[model samples]
Target: MDFLTLLQLLDTTVRLATPLLLACLAGLYSERAGIFDIGLEGKMLAAAFFSAAFAYSTGSVWLGLLAGIGVSLVLSGIHGLASITFRGNQLISGLAITMLAGGMTVLIAQDWFKQGGRTPQLEGAARFEPITLPFAETLREVPFIGPLYYELISGHPILVYIAFALVPLTWWILFRTRFGLRLRAVGENPASVDTAGVSVVALRYSAVMICGVLCGLAGAYLATALQAGFVKDMTAGRGYIALAALIFAKWRPWYALWATLLFGLFQALELRPDLIQQVIGVKVQVQLLGALPYILTVVILAGFVGKAIPPRAGGEPYVKER
Candidate 1:
């Protein structure tokens, strides 16, 4: 309604969008390489648990981040082995990874911490604190620019900036590099890529590994930066939302950022129900607001928004002789 209120909304949108943006990019990389990964949620969940556990034990967030990335990479490697090496069904393998992470995180958490699937509360160096920008204090008195800079952009943790910065980097990598060209070619036509003297399996494996690294960072941000420690299923379907976002963006990096931000805005509104009611001057149900992301996903899939064409070789195992 007002300028300050708008700034607060934008700030909340950025915070909520960070993980979604990360996970969406992860999915984009994997799917663009012809690997349909439904296990992004699982990887994030497992990484969050392990990162929190290690951070609490060692009192170092950096080590926790590395542990998270390591665990995620291991799971990604498993997916790669099952689907690429064994040539199994990619969807089933991804589902298995998700189920495995879901059960394993809780099981290990209870056994180690005895807190019913929650790690010990993190403090001090185990957590990420918001960094204040250089001119935040001095520019607080400025008009529209002041709140935009000081309130919305200046107070987030380091990972938030990294997540946003990744958009352009991803765009460049997917469009401007030789590897990017080969990766896209493989997804569209693995046989053609193979004929060109490139290893399809190797390229797909690399993409999945990058996905794992990004998902690991997303999980670490959730456990250490957004919250003090990991909770059971803290990801709470953000992975699925990110997948939907990937589809919504049609696998484009810049569009993925906008899509994640739109979903995040819905989430921010759900968190502040009164604000929605104020804006619309009508009573709004929180359940309806919460369901917005899933509804959008279904609509996009049903072609209400537009036709979404996936990579030609997506969800298919590449056979050299086939």
Candidate 2:
């Protein structure tokens, strides 16, 4: 491929990677705090629907984002209540949340918009547009750096930059802060955390809430930024892919970024089958390419790639007297 083509590929990869990166980080935070959240997909779906609905109604993308985050947090709170407060099975609780979101988004959409589970098409301030970076126009003729800067590095919505910047921030928070230490400790050994005079429930709740916020942003990006509005199940299993990415990254922030990008590259290739065939000089099945993320997930989970050890207390409810 030529340098320009390569830059185009990189640009596509970044766009596709944004939501996966956000959802992967969401799962990382929840799982690292001993909460196995299979409901990331659900939260994103719910947020996407609500964000789109609100944005279309109010003509403000910012309000839509806030609405998405609020809905996601409510669902996260439900999960926290069921798992932490009631000490129920975390997996089942997560599954319930996902199912609930799946059903409610479609139901509400059909009732409100009468478009068979799609919100009204968004326009103007309701949708996010790309922000051109400084020097992009000035450097458009500067050899290899020109296209790289203007084409690849510029012209994404602000959320894309925020998603990328979050990697280092998440890394720092999980490794460099006292809350990070306690959060990790709670996931590993809740009893030990309790003995140290910390509230295990509180930390786990906080982690799950953070997960909700990130998933909310991921949904908003999809509904308002990536597309004009929400459709039925627009998330389309990104949450599961993100979960797989979390496992693939072994719950590390930097690795999560790389893993999501790899998956995004696979998706980008799927979108451009001609490019893949050109690179390989062989006919490639689009179906197989589309299945790449799930295939990788199964491989990683089966330990064919490598052992991915989860947190010790993951998927278990903490009991103070146990």
Candidate 3:
């Protein structure tokens, strides 16, 4: 491939990976706090739909983004209440939340937009514009690597930066701050955290709510930044993939970022039908290529390197005494 072609591929890879990175990091917040969040996909889908709808109505992308995050946070709050406060089964609660969010998003979109569960097209200003790098443009006139930096790193949406930036912040939160220590302690043993005068339930609720906010931003990125507008179920199991990435990364934010990028590369390949045929030298059906990443997920989980060990108290609710 040519230099420009490689640069384009890198750009596309980052674009495709942003949603997964965002969602995986979002899931990481909850899971690291010993909460299993299987409903990330639903949250993303709901937020995407709501974001597009709000943006279309108000003609303000920022307002739409806030609306999306707000809706998903409320939905996630329900899950937190059911699983953490009520001590419900985390898996069942997450699944139910996903189903509810997905169904409600579709139903609301269909009823209101009348586009059969799809939103209207978005305007240019309603979408995220690519940001050009300061020195890369000037340096592109130098040589080959300069062109590489210019094309590959420059002109990406603001969300892409946020998605990558989140990795370090997530790591800092998990390993640095006082709340991070308490969160980790809660995941390790809620009783211990409670004994130490921390509110375990409150911490878990906060973690889950943050997960909702990240998932909401992820959904909005899919609609407004990744694509022009919302379509019915456009998230298309990306949330599950993000979950897989979270586990694959062993609950680490930077590792999850890399894992998400790998899957996103597969997604980018699937989008380019010819690339698969050329690279693999087989007339692989589009459906099969589309299935490759999920297949990989199953294989990775099924002892390719041994069983993945989750946090000991993950998915268990804590009831603290006053």
Q: What is the C-alpha RMSD of each candidate to the true structure, in Å?
A: 1.0, 1.0, 1.9
C-alpha local distance difference test of each model: 0.93, 0.94, 0.86
Candidate 2 stretches with Cα past 4 Å from truth are: none
Q: By the TM-score metric, which is better: model 2 or model 3?
A: 2
lDDT of 1 at 221: 91
Task: For residues 1-322, write the lDDT of model 3, one tens digit per residue.
Answer: 5567667777798999999999999998898889999999989998898888898888888888998899889889988988898999988988998889778987999999898888899887787778888987789887887878788778888988998999999899899999998887888788998888778888999999999999999999999888988898899999998998887887888889898988887777777778656666877777876777677667767868656667778988776657
In model 1, which runs have C-alpha deviations exceeding 4 angstroms? none
How much lDDT does candidate 1 score? 0.93
Where does the lowest 10-residue lDDT sum fall in candidate 1? 300-309
Model 1, C-alpha of 252: deviation from truth (Å): 0.6
CA shift of 311, model 2, Å: 0.7
TM-score of 2: 0.98
Shift of residue 14 alpha carbon in model 1, Å: 0.8
lDDT of model number 3: 0.86
Can you give the TM-score per candidate against the true fold?
A: 0.98, 0.98, 0.94
Which residue pairs come into collision in candidate 3?
none
Top candidate by lDDT: 2
